[model samples]
Target: MRKILAALLLALFASTAAQAKWYEASSEHFVIYADDSEEDILRFAENLERYHSAMSLVTGRAIETPSPSNRVVIFVAGGKGDMRELTGSRWVGGFYVARAGASRAFVQTIRNKSGYPHFSTVILLHEYAHHFLISSARHSMPRWLGEGAAEFFAASSFDSEGGMQLGMPARHRANEISYAGIPPVEYLLDPKAFVESDREASGSFYGASWALFHMLIFDDARKGQLTSYWRLLNEGTDSLEAGKQAFGDLEQLDKDLKKYLKQKRMSLFRIGPDQLTTRPVTLRELPKGEAKMMDVRIVSQHGVTREEALDLVEEARKIAAKYPDDAGVQVALAEAEFDAGFNEAAIAAADRAIALDPSRPNAYVQKGYAQFSIAEEAEDKDAAYATAMETFSALNRLENDHPVPLIHYYRSFVERGAEPSETARHALERASQLAPFDKALAMNAAMMQAGEGKIALALVGLSPVANNPHGGELADTARLYVAQLEKAEEGTPWQPEEGEAKATGNEAKDPVAEGAAKKPTGS
Candidate 1:
């Protein structure tokens, strides 16, 4: 009897092991383990989603990474040497490692941790874009277009009870092309110059790309020609030919671009820091009540970096010190601390802010972002996953055409081992639309489409990034998808274009109710 029981137990154990192996083998994605703690895993996973989303949006196809094998392994690196091994990456801002079939992404989280959330998301998006391009798309996009698009969406955001805002509005975004200060539109679209630029210039390249792309798509005539340009490129037409086929002559496009730039250059929003520094001040001393508090809040909400943000926080705190019960000052301090990456400090300030006035939405949003961050940084998978989801639900209600939160929401779902389905694709689509010029969002949507067997659609989406360095990887990936689609089995359902912004809130008219109430019109 003992022998029989022991054998049964052994058999049961073997069966369980086999089941585990089968589960891991079922999907192409490798689980990336950044650290032993659940917090770290959640954090790493959150970042990965944003990165992957950015990649697909940029390249206009799906990205697949194999290694750390079917699962991406994440290790908390001690120093730069370890980071080099993980990233094989030469990016300017952060440290990470990614290799085919490694299943592990060794990232350096300690050295410069300011934008870990943003950096991790962007880097993952970049590498994942490469994977999808090579494996599924079998094509290559330009490097400049790829990186520029990625940088454009690297700034993430989340919801709060108060309202929606940028996660890290690039400090120098407006500065990158100070109306008269930036290079001409020709230089921005210049493939060679884009490829040769150093790290500092990367932001400029992205800003220029965003501005140019936005002009191309939003401008009435150009929007309609988007599909034609893409089709021309796929047929091996040179960019000039593609432009001619899509728009008209190269000179016409140049004229339009230059004219648009002139209009944008003189706007107050485009003014440089030098101008801001010299601008006249309206108030000599701090005003009383709401006006004084609003001024302080504005300062806190505007800063872009850790140091700059902290300065705002200090000032807010000092004012709150003078008026201990001021809810706005506390909220301002909380927002600044959170932006600066002082999670604990942010929480403390948020608690005080809330205590002073719970109705304030800023307090809720700050606390929510902090909670989500903590959830990402936690060591427990269940806790991390749950926290991320909860925050996303709360955030979704507040966010409108804000792509950043959608990236986080999509990533949280992916981290829980979910497949890229309608829900994921919808979120991805919204992300892209929110930042129409963002290459990363487009690439993510394209990749997701390809994953769902929509290769043609993926190719169509990625066509925009075909000519530049930042988007080069995506172009490669889209080509691969098109080739595969041509040879794919006949039984597969035709891949449809991803969701449109027809269900709009801020960007459209009563889209939600209109969608529900209306019947489909025949094409």
Candidate 2:
């Protein structure tokens, strides 16, 4: 279970990183860091907030905001090329990760295209749409619909006068639409089948998705069909069956979609600032020292491989040498040190950071990580873990809703050879709630509940992973669990947190087995 929680965190959390001279803009939904003028970053943050509001209006769903620390963090690279280099994909304009403890997006100046003046913003928008939709609905959608809806909204616009266009024509998708054509309805419905079929033909997957979603949004005759299909899927119907039930005939629907794409002009849904209260965005330039280490911060946030960490920590150490007095730099050094497997060095750097700025949350997190890593090899494992738990507890006091603290709190017990107590189990569930987009964490929580015979809670927790639009082996696995549980008895078994837990000693020992460390911890 701790592996389920730690694997992702470790994969994304970095050891060393580079770049600097940054300004930060904070808003309701995002925190933007860029090496640009305050005005530019502010505008970027404002536009993102407006886009968030616009999505709420278009989808007719109320905003479900997260804790301030939990809001998505956006890093504006030096330019689009910079991000492309990081991702190692020339086709990628930008990218994002939505983790339980942290969510982040990265971009650079995007060149505009089509009628959309801000075409540069499309990548993050498309990705964010996926995050928002999945988080909001708490159910999976067909891959086609998920991507289609993201593209549809990604093509939208915000005029100088603050006017909003919800579903403008997706002219950016023209190349794909023309080359790949709309993927056949069957390919759209069955992701596995699509992958098994012609690769080149489905290259236009995103474009085809946009086309179909656009049609569904505007076609008067097909109005509400998408909703019907979504409802059916969530209600446990097979995707193709749901598609046929909602649209009647796939071949006929494909024909209609083909005809629909030929329209020289497509539908547009418009709204104005008067209809939505755009949240205010605040901006500030970072102090020179901290600004200089921002590249390190971004890379650390992006995560890296162990070998990669060895390369990065030197760069981080050099930056720290330049800004030895800076708390941010110290924190960066701590991350880099940890990433490079110098756990004691990381703990020391974290201590330096905390001494510099006691309020910094990540410093404590980094310290906790080093403590936990060190404890793994300690002869007095319980004593080492108890100290590690204190660091996370301090983080909890700093930001009670932070998913990392909640997760690690539960894990601290498990690591100590003791069963997690009622409070620890509840905290684990809450961590899943806070980071619903983190399907892995949710799955682990559900499995823990299932093991405890809390079938209903387990089912609820697993639902989102099963419905994840980016269908994968995990989604398929979760689907099996959901089906199996539903057939067993309708809420036939429920277990309390105290049910079978054998919480030992002082509670932070993770409730079992030091000798098992002689064995294996299967992730």
Highest lDDT model number: 2
lDDT of 1: 0.44
Model 2 spans > 4 angstroms off = 1-20, 110-120, 466-523
Task: Compute each candidate's TM-score over C-alphas.
Answer: 0.39, 0.86
The residue ranges of model 1 lying beyond 4 angstroms of the native Cα positions read 1-237, 243-312, 323-327, 351-364, 398-405, 416-422, 460-523
Worst 10 residues of 1 by lDDT: 514-523
> For model 2, how does the per-residue alpha-carbon lDDT over 1-523 read when each residue is reduced to its tens digit?
1111222222332222233357788888888887766666766677777788888888887646787777888887645455544544465556676667667777765332324845448777887887788777766677778778988888877766766787787877887788777778877887566663576766788788888888988999999999999899878787888989998899999999999999888888887888776778888778877776676676666666676677778778877888888898899899888888899999999999999999888798889888888998899988998899899899889888888888887787888778999998899888877877666777778877886877877888877676654435667677777877776554455332344322111101000000001000111
Supply candidate 1's per-residue lDDT for 326: 67
Taken over the whole model, the C-alpha lDDT of each candidate is 0.44, 0.72
